[model samples]
Target: MAENMTGDIISDHRERMLNLKKYYPFFRLIDTSFSNFKDGKYEILDMGYIVMAVLRFFIEENNFKEKDVTYPEYLDFLRLILKRDFGLDLNEQDSKEIADYIFDKIKNDGRPFEFSYFDPVDRKKRVSRMKIIESSIRDNTVWYSISPDAIEFYLDTKEIKDESRISVSQLLLEKMINSQNFRGGVEVVERINEEVNRLKLKKNEVLTILSGDVFAGIEAYEEFVKTGMKWFDDEEKLFKKNRDLIAKSIEKLNASGSTGEGYYRTMNEIYSLETQLKQAMNRHSELLKDCTEMQKMTDDAVRRAKLGRLRSHMDFTSALSDMIKRDNADILVTMLSPLLKPNIRKTFDLISIDDALMVKPPRYEEKELISNERPEDIEFEDEIEEKRIKDNYVFLMKNLIVCLKKSDIITLGQFADAMKRAYGEQILRNADFFSFFVNLCQKDEYQLGGDAGEDTFLDAYLGEGFKDTESFTFAIRKGLGGQVILSDNCMMADVELVRKEAHGE
Candidate 1:
């Protein structure tokens, strides 16, 4: 049955391959174009290079009118490229001859060149077809450009390494800033919109870097952090600079700008740039936040990995086996320390307390005498050998509440300081202490420090802070009224405490 199933799968694959061949006849055309040898003359006309040339041409001439390059113009461009780059001494005539042959093959193919792409959804390789579409013709010259489909296919199939990961957003942002006529017409606005879309796509790609089984590793996490941090720094600076430029442009326009249509168009351009800049900044913030979170998550994973290795080396069974090999009865209690209980519940057998208390005298035939006593109620030790972790949560909470009560509200830094003074730095050293405190503040038991009418509760405002200090400026409810100083270096969050309202004089 298994053999039959395997045969069926092979048969289906072959059938699909045949169907693909029939559906995409352009492959044969491309193959024939390269296979043809007119005395080894057209051998220099590489299909891959030809595709690249067309792509480069379309990119260079991005405008609608310019997309359609005349046949003579394209021939000239190809001649220059081949001669300069390939060191080929092909003249215009030879270049034209080769270009015509390539174009003829393309026209006859009726389809595009197909490249294999890994389809993550289907978990298989699928073909992406690429082609240059001939757009228009004038007199004797035919104008052509790359089709959107082909361009998209190329982008999707291309493998970009980390070193080559360029920020399209930064490039476009800079271009708009430098261009004198950026706010000219619909074309410029449309181009900006296109750039915005491209930026969004790039931003989404950053999110996908640490996703899936392909990159769910420590190395990927590190790469994500490195890339995201650098991008945030550079893009944030550009965003601010562009924002300033837009502000100045707006000010100038407001002072003495155009009238009617020009006025509306310029305002619209400013608004668009501002909106895009804001979005870019927001995206950078989110990416940075995600990178930070990924760092924490990967740190946890690394710690767990270490724990797994430790577990494999030092399980109870292995330790017990070692203990038995050494024949160390003195260390038996030590080996069983983890399993020893503070108090053992006794099982009540049918025997009465009187029977347990009674002593038995050995007969002459008996080997030994049995003495009975109720085991003397043995105490384990000063500390239980059960290895149970002590619960400090309640203890910490009590200390925190006492501090909060003393002061109407407190910052995380202040709280940490108080806790350090009370319980020493060891209690404050717990990594999850801040997170636990934040969660506790959100409970119904604690109230915000606002007047009778106002709605202010114990809330936290996120800010950059020093190490071993809170990253957020916290207050009891609406207790934070005035500006809180957030300094650099130690970046500690400011704390404010609001006094509870007095009931009577």
Candidate 2:
């Protein structure tokens, strides 16, 4: 015979099943408690409730300082609970015997509750063992507390929630630290990190949905905000509080001036626990930062989807029909301005001066006047050209700000379409649209709130105090691959304008 070793047919079958199998022993232990064929099928009624109550008591006791929960105290508590709830009245000797019997079953007769499971990862059967409650001997008195595994098992018996996991894990880590269970603290922090990473992936999924459908994405995002993001601040405070507690614990341990295997081992576990907590905190912070970015991404996507996308744009079909009806093709120049050409210039040099002298010059071209007084300010053709470029830059920035106001993200292809619809198709013929973008890209990000800096061309609106723009902050970058067809003469690489999200937003 050969072995058939294919992976999970349903993917995660092994993981989910393994998790479920971990609870099997606990359920069976409760069901078969003190039941024996030799004794003619004796069983404890309400054994499940009693077991759960016992676990809760152990956890709550451990949370307090030196509660010293002992076996005799346990017997007394059990006696009271049994009499109150189960209506069982027994003598002191009978109570002790019943307590010992329950204790033996819970402790698996001084052995761990063990089970074997198939480890898909290792392709082998492995044994997992755990104690529902653990005991410690102090001054010849045994102290009992709930184990971390048992606490987690208790939590799993309820509904599975996303945010509850992180919050509950933090509380568990705190409990583990309080009980000096540093090794358990490491596992708790790891679980916290996994939850944070899961949220990060969820953020990306929401953004992807946002890109395609605004209404649906907004609904999903609102739900996400309610569930996970709402508790981010509170969770961060908990992280800091726990970190400080761990630091103080390490200091206290070192101050005890102890030296031995137990002391050093505890010291090493404390340091390891601190390192895991720090990593978890850093991961949590990164998730928060990513979430802030997602807020901007979602807001812009919704607004753009609502306002930027149009149902009607330039009707080139009707315009072309009219052009043909008028029996003139020159109208094609304005209508087909998407493929406009650059201006061609010709000048006469010294070699062509003789030929140029043969042509007559125009007479009386508005009779130039010579003034004796120098003008307050003189602007030449060069100065006029510079002014025109500046004015075009300002105008382009105003429209760019308009897009920025509507949305934080706009691609060049999208902006070009907007300009063609609002300003007219001829605007694309001007070189200034692309030129302004070039200057903006060179200047990088422009902050709109502050006073105008040296990069006056792109940031000029700052000094101008443009209304509705002061709230905006912009960054320009090379866009995802594509080309913006400016004209038949040239094509520009697509650019993306991103409004940078303010910190703490």
TM-score per model over all chains: 0.31, 0.43
In every candidate, how many clashes are there? 4, 0
Model 1's TM-score against the true structure = 0.31
Per-residue lDDT of model 1, residues 1-505, tens digit only: 9999876665466444533432243344446644455577656556656655665566456421334566577677777777877678866667677767766665543334555545444458865444445354454244666554333333333432232223333333444454434443223334434444344444445445534332456665555456445555655665576678778777888888567887887788778667756654664565556567656766666677667666635476877787799987676677578687565777874335424543346657647665785557543321241111123443454455566557656665676777777768665545345434544444333332232121221122111112233222223443233332222212223344333432111
lDDT, residue 330, candidate 2 = 92
Compared with the true structure, the alpha-carbon lDDT of candidate 2 equals 0.74
lDDT of 2 at 58: 66
Best by TM-score: 2
Write down the lDDT of every candidate, Cα atoms only: 0.50, 0.74
TM-score of 2: 0.43
